[model samples]
Target: MITKVTHGWRPGGLVAYLMGPGTVEEHVRPRVIASWDGLDEGWQPDTGPGGALDFQLGRLIGALQVPATRAGLPVSGQAPPGRGYVWHCSARLSATDRTLSDEEWAGVARRLLDGAGIATTEDLGGPRWIAVRHADDHIHVAAVLVREDTGRRFWPHHDYRGLRCTARELESELGLTPTALADRTAARRPQRAELELAARQGVEPARTELARVVREAAVAATDPGGFVDLLRGRGYLVELRRLPSGDPIGYKIARRATTPIWFGGGKLAPDLSMPKLITRWGQRGDATERLDAGVLAETRQTLERAERILRGARQGIAAENPDGIAHAVGDVVAALGARYGGALGEAASCYDGAARAPYEPVPDVGSVGSELRTLAGYLLRPRRRHRDDLDALSTVALLVALAALVQQIAQWRAEQGKRHQATAARDAQRLIRCTAEERRPRRGPPRPRYAREVAVDHSRRENAVAAIT
Candidate 1:
């Protein structure tokens, strides 16, 4: 499903546009699916003697604007910009999905209103809203931003997040295509206008592309100077938000374009914010060091040591804040993705959300997480070709071990009641395992693990992906 939200100053105009003749987006028999008053029908005003559908539009418009008007606002005049007294949301189902009945759309409308705290059952003071379905696949929800009981303006907090959260549940219950849960720190999504613009320009949305570039740079960077240089080397227009004393505080980047759109690190992800990055990279002090790529045996040993600490250390990840450790682990996975971009890259990107810390900054504080951060740097450094039997075996073992580590994190997340993170981690694990199974035969000597196919749980995931071998 696709949802678009906007604030409008004119509630009557919005209501008219939604119910108007199919001028832009096609509107079939436009009818109210749901409303604040819980009316099924008959509430709509009858046409006047002039025979125009819009003749009695004022009747309904006046009704919708009651709360706003009572709150010292004009009856039909527009409010100031950005302080629009109306919230308009348009929701459309995928073309491949089945058409829902009016009753189902009503339920969806009610759920969305309640989820966003715009309205709730038995709450007389909530905002007055209506869901109008003008087409087979879409509905527009119009709401007056005033409490009916209190007659005071009410601005919703985290409305988009709440709407999407409820959307995930609705998609699942309605047997529609499932969307990835926005259950991590990186939850900024492109708006419908942005998506449309990107489509027209034949390019990725600025936000999405910049996020990937910034994240990859963050993983590879050794220090603040190196991080800036890395982005500059990639030809991005980089600028820093600095303190009055000339020390840098935050940063923003833009891709090379005729007119560039700059984004701050926080806009990309909470952890990617400048302060968080500085705090994190500052701890891993060796800025110019690189791992010995030829030492495959030593690499395996390092991974083994990481495994032991991850599995059995006295002050393990869970004892402290696990976000830092999760962030470090995700960095390693991201480096691997950058190293081999293909299906592996897809898997890595899919898992990115799972690795994010919450909105709060979590500096990679402890030694155990520090070890993983070091490994991440090692992976970011260039690797030599694997030749001898020991090298090939070690290389293969490293991939398997890394996959196992991801699975372990997934299990830990599930145990901790992070359903979305757990699901994302498991999905990444499956994809990485699948990539290994598919590409290993061509790359090197085969193992029994790749020869045997494992059964996948169809109940858990809907997509038909390669099974872990």
Candidate 2:
């Protein structure tokens, strides 16, 4: 399992993201795990058209704010009363364990919350929080940072490290496959300014682009010197750091000759560091043996086609053109299915179908692919009133699913062979950078004045259907 934690300032945004169908498909409704009153029933009421969930969320935030002001904490007057520290966590299980029941999944989530120091109010007199299960393999937990008994803020030191440790322990206890943990000791990753700049220029994020180039150069090089020279030839500024005895210790790379922003090797990834590279491939030897030229070319072409399809879908969604978005999403579903299906066929043909028998597609990819296909069906046959909401929801779901598929394909290819690793990494990075550019937080399109009325109408329709059923 893998765990990620993010700090936010608003609980409402988190709640809306989890409870609403925008990020998740309509078939997979989110399940509430915990709330302000510790109530387990009436999950549907909070999500009803009356805004009961938002109101309850407001009360919880209010409780936290009263204590914070009395404790003289830094409270911004411009922000809403409920606007404070919010920690959003996602704990994801392995794809192979997709058969786990809802009850079993919730049990795992509760245990994770307890282990991560968010289960009880004992530490700081209780903080209001909620856990919502969404998607297939993960659950999200949103918590306010202010303690109810004392208005003081709650910030856990070394929280990410603690979360990883807890995840590893849980993996063993739950008999789940263990995945890699991030190396916290490595150099910090580059900040987002360059990435945002790349977005503005209609290019891939600078960091990911540079990392991809460096990895490809490393794969093709005969030695460390060749690696540095290849990168320099490709418009990167490579600076190698060495010990007093002249042994290489680390390195920094920049996008251009004049750029002030340089990212350390370790910052790109732990394996990219000079020490790690040397340990794996040695100071002077072929980086890797080459694969068949025809096979490599075919793989690259397939990946490029997939990337283009996804990029078109992303662009359509960003422009908010519903018709164009639907067309592009359908293209993505077809392209991805063809790509994966072709690869599977090739594997089967190569070894008389035995080598491919054990190969299973990534769980997240399969789930998201199914959702996108279903979404396309809905987009083709839309209802009259819910067209706008359906468009937005399908767009968000497609974007989210596309991101996961890109990451999964990257990992899958890296495991295939050394020759395909660099190319796979580059394609994956390109897709990721493009998706990030499209989804970066910005001022959304203006809302209509009658938005509330439209929502009320939709809610009434839903309530009517519920009553009739």
Candidate 3:
């Protein structure tokens, strides 16, 4: 797992996106120093005129204290035990690489609280919530900051930028690398390249946008209501406000809605808020509930079978058995049923291609072609006497190919200095291109708003929207 810290934003957005969700349980508060002693009196919230900046700074100070405050910690005038006395700031954590199970994700939150010197408030019946979003390859988590000792309320302060470095330190403690934020690109003229292209086409958007729109429409179909239909009609979720109460609500659910929220009883919908829906559905004694349980059971069984195939392939990779390798690969591909679903075939290919290259005297640059041939012969002979297992045979072939690739690349760096420099360059280029190809978007076509047919084709155009789980 990886943690990416985004800081230096205006506090309002950061706080709303973090603490405003109203689900994060307070674990600690007054996370930093107690009070401002030597600073100007104008720094106070109720200060002199022109207090906007000062007010923000004051809010920052309070926000820093919120974690500890929620943790029931007092504002420490003097240096507190085990607490680092330095600059104050705020930060948010995003997980990368792999999706986490609910239990695994809770553990992450617990670690963050403990590592950051905020005592856990589990005893106080505090709520701990994880908001999983799919817009980016990261999970947005929010938790209330509480005081462990006094059980007091703590609010987040305004100036929270310094937490960037602090987050990195905490991430290291949890056995994760801090994902660095990419820098902004150089600014250009007001008339942008994408805009110009859209303007010239004058009808539909480029192929990319069309594909994106289709994907959104597809996933939205999963919602219980006609959420998918709504997205197709408007291209985005419709914003609406309730009168009298003035509570904010939206009509259409977003195309990609993986948010896990904790709310009152009326908000229950088996297909809407899935995690809670599942939990609630499992608790009831009804025919529908029983059917849902059976469906889940079947899904689990299918996944288990796939896992077995993948495990076998991994074993083949380790043992260097060509037939076993081929069998494993075939099993995996067959289990995927051609759709590929969320299988990491491309990543596996990288490893496989590297592993199965023809084995020359020097390692890492050639295939073990002879071994693969021997393994293939063994499998073919056995099949002649008995029923052939197509999937198993395919697995063996894939493993052999992977082993050969690995061996071929082993001595790649040996081509150093002037003599083999050109060969090295070519190898590097090939590797880069291959990796890029693996990651390229599988969906085709772009959709832009200005195209003549863009609005007409609001419905899903492809079967690309799928939930891997």
Best model per lDDT? 1
Pairwise TM-score winner, candidates 1 and 3: 1
Once fitted onto the true fold, the runs of candidate 2 whose alpha carbons sit more than 4 angstroms away are: 23-31, 35-56, 64-84, 93-106, 117-127, 134-137, 146-154, 161-205, 215-230, 239-250, 257-261, 274-469
What is the Cα-based lDDT of residue 90 in candidate 1? Answer: 82
Q: What is the C-alpha lDDT of each candidate?
A: 0.73, 0.52, 0.32
Task: Give the per-residue lDDT digits (tens) of candidate 1, residues 191-306.
Answer: 78889989999999988878777877887887677889989998999998789997779999998889888889888766778887877777563443434544344445555655
RMSD of 1: 12.3
Reference-based lDDT, residue 152, model 2: 62
**Runs in model 1 lying further than 4 Å from the true structure:** 1-5, 17-30, 37-40, 45-58, 66-83, 89-115, 119-127, 133-140, 147-152, 160-184, 285-323, 363-365, 382-395, 441-469
Deviation in Å, model 2, residue 48 alpha carbon? 6.1
Judged by lDDT against the true structure, how good is candidate 2? Answer: 0.52
Tens digits of per-residue lDDT for model 2, 1-469: 8888876665656666676665335415566755544463234334445552333344434543454456565444345555357778898888896455566665666566666676553453666666677578788777777677665677765667777777878788778877544333222344678767877879767676666556545434535787798788877889999899998888899876354578887677545678655643332222122323322232233334444544544444222222222222222333332223333222211111111111221112122233332332222222334333324433334444444545433343334332233243344335434544554456778889699789999999999999999
Clashes found in each candidate (C-alpha, N, C closer than 3 A): 0, 1, 96
Comparing 2 and 3 on lDDT, the stronger one: 2
TM-scores of all predicted structures: 0.73, 0.45, 0.21
- Per-residue lDDT over 386-427 for candidate 3, one digit per residue giving the tens place of the 0 to 100 score: 222323433333333332332233233122122122232234
